[model samples]
Target: MSTTTREAAGRCPRCGAAVHGDGRFVVWCAACDWNVDPAPPDEDRGRPARVRRALARRHGEHLLAETTDGGAPGPRRDPAALAAYAIALLVHGVTVVLAVGGTWFLVTGWGRPLMAVGLFLLALAWTLRPRPHRPPEDGTPILARADAPELYALIDEVAGVVGTRGADLVVVDAGVNASVTTCGVRGRRLLTLGLPLWEILTPQQRIALLGHEFGHYSNGDARHGRVLATAYRSLTTWRYYFAPAPDPSLLDLLVNLLSLPPRAVVHGVLALLDQLTLRATRRAEYLADSAAARAGSTEAAVGLMDRLLVADSAMTTLRREGNAAQVVRRGTEAGDRADGLWERLVADTESIPEGEYERQRRVGALRGHSVDSTHPPTHLRRARLLSATPVPAAVAMTGGRARAIAAELAATRRTVARHIVRHGFPG
Candidate 1:
């Protein structure tokens, strides 16, 4: 319900008078006779039923009930859960083993007392391993200063509909992509948009994009993602330090001969843990997409897909051009002719801004990466949105509008393609 005001006095959109008003809901442009109220009152807004229904459809009714009813489903202490548990166990077990072993070795005069001290230190390090903690900042610095006020507003509106706290907005000076990261004392959530994407998407498309990011945050996808990352890190650490080894050096060989079996057991356990974490991550992505559909407009989800594709295509062209230019500039600087027709083509394309080129490249890269990565492919996601049945009327309206927008976007892509072919992509 709290609103922030813009500093400058502006002419009323309806009447030409200097005025002050809240920027969130109302904007008065005096000279052009423009008074724009972009958002509705807070009390009248709530999470959309369509979003709930879609979530129920994808994740089942019980999931929503669990989140709202405050039922402790307890920890997901399954096999993967066991893996995390095992790490704790191993830490304790190793400490006991070292303490006992060091005492015996010292009593028997088989090794120096320093070995006992060293083992204790190692045990302590394992037991007190630093977990990934959120950064201290409550808000994302990048989102706060990015050029797109409308994008942030849209995200806030959608957050209202889903009954989730809005993420701190962030802007990466990158191109054609968006992602949500959690930072803060407890890993509080943050949403980041690429600058190029802000300049490119229409208002509706932008809302859909924000919806996707919110979907991830609302569904606890970020937490699940972090878990998976942690599991991988744990697995790698165990493998690197504790795995058994055959060593050629006489002293090293003696050490490995003693530790190999236990190390191998630990390695196997961690590998199993890694697999369980990965499965959880993939499931989380699907659930988040469902949440996004439930939180705001299903149409927004679909429109977001279309815009993503458009942005990707644009970026691809830009990257190709950018690389070519880099090669030519280097060749020219070295007094060598830029040879090869393909090389010439690349050089011609490289005149575009580096920021713009990087944006396009990132989009293209996202398409390739999302496949093996946790997030589902964009085309598959779009299909899921379209196939979702028995949609509520409000969601239907939003979806209908979104479809129209997608059609327009498709046409626009074709126009841009033609222009690129003729002009070698705009600068």
Candidate 2:
């Protein structure tokens, strides 16, 4: 379902190694890293995107340098982090002011119009209020502790290694990624494990993934905290409400012109937040990777990075399989075609050669691919894991336990396969 073509290119200018490309991707030396961070594509050529990229690169470089110099990442009180918290508080303060003003108008209004104004203000306050994160109601299965005790036991062991609580819920979905986040007002931990990614990982790499997620909690990642995170979300919601409509009508243009000042203020606050938290968040990721290394050994953590580097390939394989089922529908039901999709995806991902991994690493360097903009570059993460002091795995998995976990997930895998068949894999 997945294929690659390769041909020799010129020698690397830096290392004299024979460079190669498929004529479709970048050609670069995997040995000495020449042309790896070439000029990025035109899609990100906008001034705002360029600025974000520059800030991200600077943050990553500085943090990587600090860690390489033997600095261990812990919660540090920096002015930037303080400023970020201040701005977040200021945003929440605005919502509170709106609520108070609305309530005052409602209670003391002398006339109907004043009461209507109060109602409008209250609506605005509600719209701008900070919200806690919640799990999506998209029918993705959520497994409780009793449903998968052995799997929960494994996660609990990894959580202990990372000095955090195990997930309260295990969510399965048709994705090629995994993450841990808190949900709802109580800050309940939830592990959203992507079946496609889980299927391809070795038992140890799975431990590393869990460790990296739990590390977010142990390392005090501000983005995972409701206070700052909800503030960011509130600001984003404000920005969205003020954003100019695409293909604007005259009325829309008038609204945009009238709202320009507040919009500018919101944009400025958002930019300030990004600047303040950029360094802290990026460092949190590096520290989380360290936790992964501590939990599952440096080798497994680095292997996890390699798998992430080629995640696009895994998704492509899923897309191909899904597409094949549709294109070759020879009187077969969707369920018939969806059967064993996860198995095929696992096979395809495992069949990737070591050479392909190298190419992807180079490509990741070239494109500055990361889990997201909040994260440092994948190349940097992999490099840090390799350069950091190695630690033996604190949590090891036996074959029997691994099989039991798989058995627990078997029904969920079937559900995910059906969802993928109907919706295809998410991009």
Candidate 3:
């Protein structure tokens, strides 16, 4: 979940201890692990319109509750949001223009040597901008195109259906999610599939999940991702270079104190960009969810989201016990028993909340994401899907056959296993 005021808001209802958050969701009492209910409020069930969704998708969480029943969201032509975003980007453009123009004036018009130092600062910021090296797999298993024709073919057909560009790489990561991203200096497009996430879903649900990622591509979110990523990297790099120096001694402290004003100026600009982009980020998620509903069955899309709630907890439990390497090793070992692998993942995920604390954990995971969250809360996303009036498409697949397909990726799984053992598990 996105960070919320609930972390320090009040006492836990069950235990009455000072409440603390586990970050995404599940505020708890450190003494007893008791928690407040995290589910969407039942009293407010008004259907959300598009403009309202776009608005709620911003920092205001309660705005989602102001919906009228069965009101479909509007088209992407959200003038207010678009205008806000334009204004933000325009602000960024103006900064660039002023910097460039000022630098030119300092260098040519006024030949003042010391004043010309400002141009050097602008040049330094540009030179300090980041360059990409490689796309991160984050310990995700890789499936080569040549080795897995069946999986590649499925991805290809799905991309064609969604009318988006096909991915050059398929990554099997450990999560209850899937996504599309561009990485590497060449900006290679990647399609990431959470392998264990796939195990929890029916074939149709899997299709809907994949469709969700492709939806981002079709809606231009994926393309925008690379651009924003470059900007973020550049900002971070510049911030690091301009930030206060480390204080190991009195001399270092004095240097940082002297540099405070310049650091504050740089930080102010960074914060401004973050504030402006928050709404658009949430809008992108809403749009992608709608695209998923249109490309696949709404039922399947909803089911996939429901599964994700539980899967987050399951992945944590599965990995935290030092079983990440074991899971991958076992996946590669299962030949005809691939169904057993799927069953194991599903059973553990479902059984995560046996104890009181665990139950609290589950409920907490179900709550909404934080303000300025990349994706909206699960309930909000589900509500949007339910409220959307787009035509749903039917998908065909055999469960047993799909299991066989998953089984066939043993070699790639083993490759990931070797990498994990060599570098230590990511978790």
Best by lDDT: 2
Q: List model 2 lDDT by residue over 88-113, tens digit each.
A: 89999999999999999898884767
List TM-score per model, in order: 0.48, 0.89, 0.65
Error of 3 at 16 (Å): 15
Report, for every candidate in turn, its global Cα lDDT versus the true structure. Answer: 0.47, 0.81, 0.57
Query: After best superposition, candidate 3 residue 72: deviation in angstroms?
Result: 7.4
lDDT of 2 at 416: 86
How well does model 2 score by local distance difference test?
0.81
User: For residue 364, what is the lDDT in candidate 3?
Assistant: 38
Q: What is the C-alpha RMSD of each candidate to the true structure, in Å?
A: 19.9, 3.4, 9.6
In candidate 2, stretches whose alpha carbon ends up further than 4 angstroms from where it belongs are 1-49, 247-251, 328-333, 369-372
Candidate 1 residues lying further than 4 Å off, grouped into runs, are 1-128, 131-141, 145-152, 169-176, 196-202, 222-231, 242-267, 274-280, 294-296, 306-315, 324-373, 390-427
TM-score, prediction 3: 0.65
**Candidate 2: 10-residue stretch with minimal lDDT:** 40-49
- Pitting candidate 1 against candidate 3, the one with the higher TM-score is 3
Across 33-124, the per-residue lDDT of candidate 1 in tens digits comes to 24322332232121222332233244422333343244212224356555555664564455466556656555665367666665665564
Please report how far candidate 1 places residue 347 from its true position, in Å. 19
lDDT comparing candidate 1 with the true structure: 0.47
Residue 131 displacement (Å), model 2: 1.3
Check candidate 3 and list the clashing pairs: 1-24, 2-369, 2-370, 50-73, 50-74, 135-184
On a 0 to 100 scale, what is the lDDT of residue 250 in model 3? 87
